[model samples]
Target chain A: MSRVIQIAGLRYRYPDGTQALDGIDFHLNSGESVALFGANGSGKTTFVLHLNGLLRGEGSIEICGMRLADGTLEQIRSKVGVVFQDSDEQLFMPTVLEDVAFGPLNLGLSPDDALTRARTVLKRVGMAHAFERAPYHLSAGEKKRVAIAGVLAMDPEILVLDEPTTFLDPPTRRDLLSLLRSLPQAKVVVTHDANLARALTSRAVFFDQGRITGQGDVIEIIQRFHWEYS
Target chain B: MHHLVIDRWSRGSSSLHQRDPRAKLAALLVFLVVLSTTRPGAQWAFVAYAVLLILTANLARLPILGLASRAALVLPFSATFALLTWWSGDSLRALALAEKSFLSGTAALLLVGTTPLTGWTAALESWRVPRMLILVIQFVYRYLFVIAEQVQRMRWAALCRGPKQRGFRLAAGLVGVLFARSWQRADGIYHAMLARGFRGRFVPAPPAPFRSSDALFLSTCLAGCLAIRMLL
Candidate 1:
């Protein structure tokens, strides 16, 4: 019913004069799951970084039509949960419980509340038994689950996942995809996997060389990209 | 996997390994202080101290040699002989000093090797150590092994293909990389800790408390130490 995230004329270039994003306009509706499909260096990571105010570009980003600003950055981040591509980088804490507790703790939840939320999310991700295990001691699939739980504990309404299935074995990937599909939030996913994009979202946008190539059904883009390239 | 560092030191079945870390730490420190305060080799006194340390180690099932080697690793190049030559006093004093230091080191190793790092940290909390100090110690102890492992892995990886000298540079660069990685890692950990609402005090896991046997064993050891220091 409402545009939860809106962007227009977003242009960003690295200081070394390499352009990463150019004239990007995108919007995410409330409770919509959208997939951003692109090949390598298609500026997907840069775009998601802007969502959480981790980067700045020439374009505007409006969450529920509010402009990104100093006060709003934290609010935007709190509302928009982002799981980075590398679970290794994301799950850097000593123990699973501690990592899961981090975001809520930052939000100033009491220790018991933080522990409660942490335990709940860990159980949701099927990692309840891994509460005391260190990050380096986990399997890749388990680490990814822990990372997602870390974000889930924050209770964000919008989830942005960057390449969630990378490095996972087939079974682990399937589990992760199923988990993603089950989340009730509005999701904007950036991935190179076409079938995953088709399986997870009703809407799809193709990005290439710093600009949008087309926007339509994921199956259509998949067929179109293959046809044009072949 | 119960990969406790304490187990690395011993396989002993003694109740000392299961004792409260706070009591052990306090006792060990007191023993070390008394030994240090004593003038060099009082043979009878030194023998008694050595027997105490060895007895503790034996009971804890810790490898005395492994602990001793580790303790001696921090020694300067000039050791027993150098002390013998350098000391203005008699050779007995030199021997005594070395023996005393060795006993102190053994006591420390026995304490640490028997107690889990987390348990020892909780013991610090029990002793009213400042929260910030405990946090700092915890972080340093937790990451030290991580950083070491990373550095070793990096070196090994580089050594497989590169020249030895080149590998050294790469490994040194890895050390620098580790510094950056650890800083980033520390930031992530700090945030993760903050998110989890970790304010300060370490959460102590209450293992089974002291049994009658543990008290009797500690009391016997305590009595022996007092007797050795006072009587002999």
Candidate 2:
């Protein structure tokens, strides 16, 4: 498959003189699923923000053969389906159906088309009955599913997840991992769930001090890190 | 903690419920402005406003009785001001305050009764409302239930520990706990948005195709109301 993302010499600094990312390089191919592992404050979240240009970074990053630009951020956003870790912040709509339909409608789909797509994605996520339910009434698992549906309505080529599993009940976490594993888009999961990483990903990129310190097959990378520590 | 079985009309069905939310919003706003602009003792206008409110309530299938209780909720605060007018021997001013307060409540009740929460949001989206603003409203509406749920759970937990004879006294820690839990819940949602490539802008509300009937109804009602206020 063709390369879906290319990041070269990426460096990012916050306004407070804190460098969030330091000279990093990474690439992801279409259909690949990669785990981006790191400790807290390790720039994992910052790097994911750069994917959709929610946060600006220095140097070069290209998505789907198009060089990302300020003017084209919205277009790039539509193409990269991201499921934020916070389902509450992601689902900022009064009802489930409207929340899911948001992305497609923004992309200029007709109301009927957008609602149909929302229904399809919600059903796919096993949430067909929650069309009118408030996001607040939903359990954590349900909220996460609805958030995923919101992104799925966009049908992005690359789904970039920021800590896809967090604070979820074990069953919900497993279900979410399975759901992420099932999507066809290339994935970059920023997660601390070792089991989740092992079960869902084929490749691993060890992120440290704002850069990729190691990249290889999942087992090799996990084995290397485990052996070094043990 | 929130009760599940709140009054239905405050959250129910009628032809008013079926109308476009933007129309309902505009109608309510115009009606409120007209009612407020009237002289304090424009007795004729007050009767006209009350008549219009009742007619709309009938159309919206709302309970006329509950309108008073709902009106009462807004009355106490404004009553103090009305009391001042009464104390100053301005019975006319007092009457005006009373009329304005009741009419304002009537206008709001009609608006919310006619418009479901979701439809109001969809209307805002179709109007090219800023994504962030729409998202704020969406999040507030969705999580209002979540906050209610959290409070309910905490109250249940408190009751489990406290004796029945103790009465319904809220614990100091309960507020802190509820806020913390909701905060954490909010954190999870924010992270989910980031994962899915949410860049602060919310998904826009879908706009339904405008039917001729909708246009006709909106124009006639609005025009008639305007003529009554301005010309008559």
Candidate 3:
């Protein structure tokens, strides 16, 4: 399998002088899914943000064979879709359809074509009935679904989801896991849910204080870290 | 929740709602200008303006009382200036000041009540309003609910700890924490935007075609405002 993401010697420090991501190396093969397991402040989110050039850290990062640079920023972003932890933050457009169309519109799709793509993806995610609805009006599950649809509309090669099941009930979480499992893109999921990691990912990486502490098969990583609450 | 109500109202199927946003915006401009220039002692003109707004609200199938009550939110701000005028021995001007402000608020609310945010903001974009200003407005409107919810949660947490913790100190602490949370949320939102390939400017959707009915609507509004100003 071809590598979709490759990172070497990656490090980031916040403006306030906090070391968020220490020197790290990681890679994801095409169609492979990896779960990032870490504590709240363990740099999981900071590391994933670098995949799409959202954060400018000191690193040699490549996406789908394209080196991270100013000119390749847009192309790289289009390749790596990041679904944020907070659905409210991600779904910023006035209506569900408009929000879903946002990425395509940015990627230079014509409004008509963009709206059509948005509709198809919304239907794919089973949110077809919420096209005209405001984002604030949606239930948590529906909002999560629409957020996923927004990213899917772009048709990225890699999906980076941070805590995708944050506010979901068990049934909603199960539905999301099934939907996520069906997607073909390579994924880097930053989550605390061991069950989700076990169910969706083949590999797992553990982070501690801005460094990778462990990496291996998903179940083994979970077992090694004592990740789940008893 | 109040904004949510306005949001739902904006999606109505009335003729006013169906009218092009540009047309309604033009009508709102005309009404504001005419009402602002009306003479202070012409109380009848103010009454006429109020009646005209009520009639438009009726035509739009909106609850007039709801519109009036929400519009009255502007009264306290205008009341201070109105009081100054009253203290300056121009009671007529003070009353007219309040009347003009109230009527203007109602008229503005009418346009937004009938036109969805995307519709009206798109109209503003077409009119060459600064893209940055529009972005700020859109962001503020979108995140207001999130911020409000945060405030409620924080307040609830505080109340859970101690019911007596209700005063300036608690309120001040809440504001400080809320500001920090909002800052973090803003950063997340900007990152989300960039991850979705947002460049410096937002990509606007293509504007809808303005039909002949839209032009007719603008003309009718212009004529009504002019007639009221000249005759009443």
Highest TM-score model number: 3
Over 4 Å off in model 3, which ranges? A9-23, A56-59, B40-47, B76-95, B166-171
Candidate 2: which stretches are off by over 4 Å?
Answer: A56-62, A67-75, A93-95, A106-112, A132-137, A217-230, B1-11, B22-67, B90-96, B117-232
Model 3, residue A210: distance off in Å is 3.4
| Model 1, span A175-203: residue lDDT tens | 98898888898999888787778778888
The local lDDT score (0 to 100) that residue B155 gets in candidate 2 is 74
> Across residues B77-147, which tens digit of lDDT does each residue of candidate 1 receive?
33655475557656776576567666776777787787755557777877788867877875675566567
Interface root-mean-square deviation of model 2 in angstroms is 3.9
Interface RMSD to the true structure, each candidate:
5.2, 3.9, 0.9
Name model 1 segments beyond 4 Å from true: A64-67, A195-199, A226-230, B1-28, B43-98, B110-157, B160-228
Give DockQ for candidates 1 onward, in order. 0.18, 0.28, 0.74
TM-score of each: 0.74, 0.69, 0.90
Give per-residue CA lDDT, model 3, range A1-230, as digits (tens).
Answer: 89999999999999999999999999999999999999999999889889999888998999999999999999999999999989999999889999999999999999999999999999999999999888989999999999999999889999999989987999988998899999999999999989889898999999999999999999999999999977
lDDT of 2 by residue, B1-232 (tens): 2123222353565767777788777677778777777776667767777887788888777778777677777788779888998999999989889778878987876776666666676677777787678667757766786578668777777778865634433555777778788787877666545444456555444376766666766776677566667644
Quality of candidate 3 docking, DockQ: 0.74
Worst 10 residues of 1 chain B by lDDT: B1-10
